[model samples]
Target: MRSTNFCLSTEGADVILATSSDEKYPPENIIDGQSETFWTTTGMFPQEFVICFHKCVIISKLTIQCYLVQTLRIEKSMSKDPVDFEHCIEKDLEYKEGELQTEEFSFPEFQATHLRFIILSAFDTFVSVHRVIAEGIAQDI
Candidate 1:
């Protein structure tokens, strides 16, 4: 059978620590399948969060929805634990007034069990990450 793309969050994906947390706007909101809910920065710049897939996933495309963020970086790891991640992509996002910033990345071939998103900086004092979606094929293991 041919492989098909699907959202990892719907298949038992979860976010790791090293992320700013708030009860009303927790980091889990980034993958909670709710657009109105988002994870907000509780402190200074260079905030980040790691997402762990339930299993090995070959992701071809990744999308992140946020606002006021100026620079961001994505890293990936194939190990069982959320460590030893290699640099994947880094890009600066454009600011849109009163609008959410949607960033999409298409990879040639990326296999990972964990993904880490690093927010280098933002246009405002704080940033809000609405959601993170990974589209790919999950491995049989």
Candidate 2:
């Protein structure tokens, strides 16, 4: 199957909730397909953002681009609403100076309607998530 960027906001994915947001930075930027635009955390650690797909999809991999992020956790839910989520992946990222941190995670084929990405901690007090790309195939329910 062809891999597609399911996280694109124009593709019907949405950022339902975010713990912190600056006036110029919003969670929606995470799925906007541009690395220059990013969502910044305005407060403490343990920030989060939830993305809801238009429909169920079988996700194979995920790519995240961010700055100053240290620990990241991802959860998934198949329910229509963003609830009953199960743990998917968690990782501690390396810091890259003068550049964005790019990480790729591969997963067993699984279907989900919503994906929640949590920033448990960061290398800096403030963190910014540039983009999150989900490679998946849409499944007909």
**Judged by TM-score, which candidate is best?**
2
Off by over 4 Å in 1: 1-9
What is the lDDT of every predicted structure here? 0.85, 0.93
Kindly report the root-mean-square deviation of model 2 from the true structure over all alpha carbons: 0.8
Q: For residues 71-99, could you state the per-residue lDDT of candidate 2 as single tens digits?
A: 99999999999999999989999997888
Clashing pairs in 2: none
In angstroms, how far off is 122's CA in candidate 1? 0.5
Task: Give residue 124's error in model 1 in angstroms.
Answer: 0.7
Writing each residue's lDDT as its tens digit, candidate 1 over 51-126 gives 8885898888888899999999999999999889999999999998999999999989789989999999999989
Give the number of colliding residue pairs in candidate 1.
0
- Model 1 compared with the native: what TM-score? 0.92
lDDT of 1 at 13: 76
